[model samples]
Target: MPTAASSPKNEITIVGAGIVGLATAFHLLAEGHRVRLVERGGVAEGASFGNAGAFAFSDILPLASPGMLRKAPKWLIDPLGPLTIPPRYLPQITPWLVRFWRASLPDRYRASLTAQGGLMRFAATATQAMVAQADLAGHIRADGNLQLYESEAELAAAQPGWEARAREGIEFEHVRGERLAELQPGLSPRFVAGTFTPHWQTVSDPYHYALALFRAVMARGAGLVHGEVTGVEADSRGVRLRLADGQVLNAGRVVIAGGAWSRPLARSLGDFIPLETERGYNTTLPPGAFDLRRQLTFGGHGFVVTPLSTGIRVGGAVELGGLKAPPNFRRADAMLTKAARFLPGLRTEGGRQWMGFRPSLPDSLPVIGRSTASPAAFYAFGHGHLGLTQSAATGKLIADLVAGRRPPIPLEPFRPDRF
Candidate 1:
């Protein structure tokens, strides 16, 4: 019997209702294509719901860097440190770690920086245009980010990275003493130097921003399907999406934007990507928790304090535990304790803790090109910590491909089978 694929193949289905998937739907809808968003759970309830809501366009540095490699030994030793690997999952994650180490090689790291910077440049433009076109300007905040350093040594150590950002045309000022105090008051005196990016921006709340995008797409005639996609088969006719309970949907083209859960789907389609889950934990305090003037980055400790409309969010750390592990609220507690000490007046009570997976690639670049198995299918996950920051650009690029137009940037760096 014929299914929905028999229809003129006008509708495009995007898997995952997170920011990436939703943004893709938005762009597809704008291109005059019918759109359907399929999700396994509530929209934005994954990493999108709990992230520190920074636009972070200036953050083009890849996580798999020599700097991070140097710090990994100490970080991995602490069970609740910024980076960790659960004992039981060590064997499973070893392969990904080995790839990560390769990516950290000096030459590869430089290439990644160039690729990331290019994507970020496109992302900044794409985000502005999308926000304006979607009428989401009200939800954005232009407050700068203050990245604090503990001592002169730490600041000096980070100078090269700062120079890299400057070369990329990202504006920032190195500040201290009175200037630093004015930018962010109540900061612990222990922080002797800081880099302030005056143009840095953030959303009022990440989940709310996602909600607004969801509303924008829906208002433009986008639809949603609630199901777990278990199988995908793309043929000359179109693509068929299968849910676990045997329900099937058909679309002319599909974008696999399912975040951390996307690897298996890509594998089923014969694209073996080395995707890993960067499990990040965070704690959100109730409103009035602190007089945070702007986002505060304690980069050395692997966290940031974001002032959200809903609350004060404090968290950032990578737990290399796999998808099925139970929540370790201890990570949240540790970040909160550190936050209180740094802010000197933070109210850590009435805070909510969260854990979520960031789908990551070894080279810190997302897979944003055609699937090796099917031209009708595309891969768009693995943005890692920058998923939200890069969502609109991914959307625009993917939409261009679906429309049979040339993408604005080279997609070779983000191809699926690169690993």
Candidate 2:
């Protein structure tokens, strides 16, 4: 058993200043530990800044499910489809794809749900706490989210997912006609059916939320280093970080939370993980592009329309095009086209497109425990689309682990060595 006496407060260095890294720094600083946060770019520059801004606690289903393999061929062939895999990248990703297939088995799928549910159970409360602490309550809305279907058959086809959610005790209400229109006015009449989950939340500005957290952590005495981390070396006594500019920094402990760039650092520390990048694209319209009271998902279209402080953001779709691939803004345009079809009256012109990489693993779970290679090193990356949703809880759990206190949730499922 781990004890507090065995793990005293020490100077800590955290790599990556995205949502996850900043959240970890916040927790550690609150615990009276000295913390230094390192980032290649500015804060919230990656997926943390451009996400859909949804705190989707009810979306516990993994991306790889039983029926996905059957649809893979079609999705792979359709360049503009919701899921795309570049033909050139197939050989490089085959091993990871194989693991993804095995993870989609009935048994493994259920286990993933259980493990994901355990982490999401803390999502709502933790997010609320962080928002309140950072005085970012103005940037969040609790109006819930809607998943719309165009026809009865389409709604019927989603029964299995609803059943799974029900088994997990997720609350939802089915609506149509007047009820749907009452909840979301001006919606197209083509959306004949909808499912609403009131427990879901949204951030009016994801980048602002991250920046608020970063400022709060800094106020609490955490240092920020603006440099690209080239390598990391860890020993029993401490960890050393190498920068691209030939600067070296050292700390008594280190946490590697560098989203898509984490693999190289982890490999240097002797822990190999099957981390891949899920290239995601989004388009942001002007402030008055559409009127939306809450977040809306066009299920058939595989995209979400969220009301943000800046404007309306339509984001979704997965592309396995690695980190070095050029941005495919065409994917963003396709989403805008779909969004226009979903809401015929909405303006789709003058929109800004963006592409960001989401760190992902075969099992759809983040690595969130001590690295076997070094006791002073910890892992907290590969969160897929749930990075913003699980950031606060992950931060608290990591703080507990570093302090030698038992985590609120089991770490076995998210262990770094599980791969």
Candidate closest to the true structure, highest lDDT: 1
Each model's lDDT: 0.92, 0.88
Give candidates' CA RMSD values in order: 1.6, 3.4
- Model 1 agreement with the true structure over 307-392: per-residue lDDT tens digits: 99999999999998989999898998999999999999898899999998999988889999999999999888999999999999
Where does candidate 2 stray beyond 4 Å? Answer: 1-9
lDDT of 1: 0.92
Question: What is the lDDT, from 0 to 100, of the residue 306 in candidate 1?
Answer: 95
Q: Best-fitting candidate, measured by TM-score?
A: 1
For model 2, residues 1-419, the per-residue Cα lDDT tens digits are 53543332357889999999998998888888889899989898988999999999998888777867766777767789888888888888889899899999999988988888888987777778877876778878899999999999989988888898888889999999889998888887789999999999998788998998888998898888999888888886688888999998877899999998899999988899999999999999999898788999986766899999999999899998899889899999999988887787789888889998999999898889998899999999999989999998888889999999988789899999887
